[model samples]
Target chain A: MSGIYSERHTLEKTESASETANEPVKKGDTAEVKESVAVNKMRTEFAALAVNEAFARAAAAAFFSRLDPTVEELTEIKTAVSEAVSNAVIHGYQGGSADKTVVMECEYENSGIIKIAVSDCGVGIKDVEEARRPLFTTGDAEERSGMGFTVMESFMDRVAVESEEGKGTRVTLIKSLDISYYGV
Target chain B: MKTEFEITDNILIAKLSGEIDHHEAADIRSDIDGTYAAFKKKHIIMDFSGVSFVDSSGIGVIMGRYKKTAENGGITAICGCSEYLRSILYMAGIFTIVKEAKNKEDAVKLVKRLEAAESGEIFQEEKEAE
Candidate 1:
């Protein structure tokens, strides 16, 4: 699992949140915003293992922490990531194939918006709309509650899903940081 | 994930600690459900104060147990959840069937009432069965 993260540690820090450049720098001025946009992308090819469900969540949570989200917001993101990854592992790969990979990408804007995407190379959903409905699970064989998409939609600001049958699925989730938490 | 269980009378209280995700929920659901059956408990109280993190799968675990216990004429209550968890529970429609308590003691009292009601003591027939 650690191998997935180390594969791509492309950290691009963009100074998008600061107006320090607009301020005239006096001789004694030492104050600056000192913040930047953090972009990170990682991919993992595990055996559709159940333990990787937590791994996915942990990885996403760690990535989102760069934005300094509140505990509540962090929990919400973690839950959303867990649902997407769980769907990939259980429904996508059907619990393990010889060569399967789940790719996750996250971008944190200095303006406090976080975007996350989890993609898998496995059997994709036939109908994305029906899947998003509450309690609309296709994995009845595993006692799945069918609440994965519902949970993701509920926790994140927006959720988008794209899939092709016999191809794969990709889910995107977005959440803006609560302004009160950042005082921005 | 770590689970601690304490039984008094017919109520089984389970305290879940650590992060709860799909993986953890899978094991926790089995463990708690198994313990609930093994103890022959009439009600269940889940304490989430020790739990630091939870996702939708955690919601699934609690919902599954609530249904299982309810089917057997038992009650399930939750206590010690963070404010955010309470919000999630409400939005997920979990609050419709399962009630919330401020703490374990309060949950026990709530379950006592529910158990009494289930046994027909709160309504009538306290003496019919006795």
Candidate 2:
């Protein structure tokens, strides 16, 4: 699990932007955003237990509710979070050891963009490409659909995977809401 | 999650309620499989009306049950899926193998019709039309 600590350190380095919570951060004149935007971030670590799956979804929903996302968008995000967390529990931790934990981080900007990352310290994925394929599960055939990555990819705009064979895996998902279309 | 089972005309109707995730999948599976084994029913109808949420694990549960029923020379039908659930199931290609019914009654009717067809018995609808 030392790898998990290292991963956390790296995340902290990149998350400096969230240090000024609720404060408007100035963005460079980029096509995505030209105005200063309020940014919020949340992070949680929980035991790699299957029961925590529902908890994780609720946490994400509650945190992102400030955006006033549409019902459809909310459900889509929750489903993607569930898939990522489930992968951390079932595959990353290899059936979930009590000592192991899954870490989740969510960062949202008023610009209608959200980034979520779920990480676990366990046996990491060897073939990221194959794992992303629909119905390519290495788990029990009868109990696993091997559609975790597929579902996440379908629900979110982007899905990124990082892993080491013996260390762990981290999955990051990002989605941008069309707030103007929804009039939110 | 909680599941209620009703046996009618040798068909098992399972009404599942609550969140369907990996944590609750084992219990659901045992409940359905146990009752299925006891009744020796050939067809199953999974009613998802009470279900609030589902992930990939739910897909596994459905696929596993579908395989079991098919192996026993039976079929599986699902009814009362929310639109969100339907999309997820469709993405997983579950609908290609498992029939979707508008409601529990429709599912029961479908299974009965299929059963009769398999046995070379004329369904009442066809008989009446004749």
Candidate 3:
């Protein structure tokens, strides 16, 4: 089961903004404030498998570790990640289709904010709004509780879904951190 | 996730350990539901002390068992959940029907109480006769 999803992920891109604070201030002159900005981004692909749900959550938690999120925050992120990945694996692929891949993207900013996007190039949702409703699931009632989107909305600061019928679906989740909690 | 089940006095005690996600939900659900059916237990007590994480799929597993047990005039109780896990379960509106406990012993007592209440046996026969 574990072999269905690949662990190899690339650190696709990295961007850093650095400013030197070497400017001498003169009397009656305004001094420029030097600011540094760091952006971290990563993208990974996984097979549409039920077992990879754990792998997605673990990967997201590790990516957000640099922000030093609290236990609650960490769990929230993990839950959201799990939901998104599960949706991709179960609904998007509509079975254990190993040929398709679910992609996960993680972005971190120095501004104490993290944005994650889970996308699948599989059968897209026909009605995203209806699907987002609580207790709205297309899967078997005996198997699904239909609270995936509800859980994601509750755990994340912001949630959005973009999908096209027959193309695929993309779920974007953003969370703002209280840097003070982690003393970051 | 791994689940261990013990039956005593018609109560099914399920001790779940490890992380519960979509990957583990199916197996765990089958195991719990299968055991609960085979034994005809009157109540279920889920111990979450060993659980470190749970996702929405986990809720499906929990709700399925609760619904099945409720259908048979049985009650479901969960115990030993961390604050994080409790909050997640709470947000999912599981508390509307399910009960929570601090420990395994309290959970057993809760299930017993619920069972009695379900059977209208909480009040003594003399009280009811009066």
Q: Candidate 2: what lDDT?
A: 0.83
lDDT of 3 by residue, A36-128 (tens): 122577788988898888888899999888888988889899999999998998899986578889999997655466778898988999998
Docking class of 2: medium
Predictions in order: lDDT = 0.73, 0.83, 0.77
Clashing pairs in 1: none
Tens digit of per-residue lDDT, candidate 1, span A46-96: 556667777777888887776678887888888898889888888898865
Model 2 residue B66 lDDT score: 98
lDDT ranking, best first: 2, 3, 1
A1-184, model 2: which lDDT tens digit per residue? 1221122212342333233433433456534543323367899999999889999999999999888899988898989999999998888888887788999998775557777889888899999999999999988988799999999999998787888888998887777776742212
Per-residue CA lDDT of candidate 3, range B1-130, in tens? 5699988687899999999888887788888988998998878888989988888776777788888888988888899988877777776788887888999887877777666776788733332210
Q: What TM-score, to 2 decimals, does candidate 3 have?
A: 0.83
Ranking by DockQ: 2, 3, 1
Weakest 10 consecutive residues, lDDT, candidate 2 chain B? Answer: B121-130
- Which portions of model 3 miss their true places by more than 4 Å? A1-38, A180-184, B122-130
What candidate 1 gets wrong by more than 4 Å, as runs, is A1-47, A141-143, A178-184, B120-130
Clashing pairs in 2: none
- lDDT, candidate 3, residue A151? 90
What TM-score does chain A reach in every model? 0.72, 0.81, 0.77
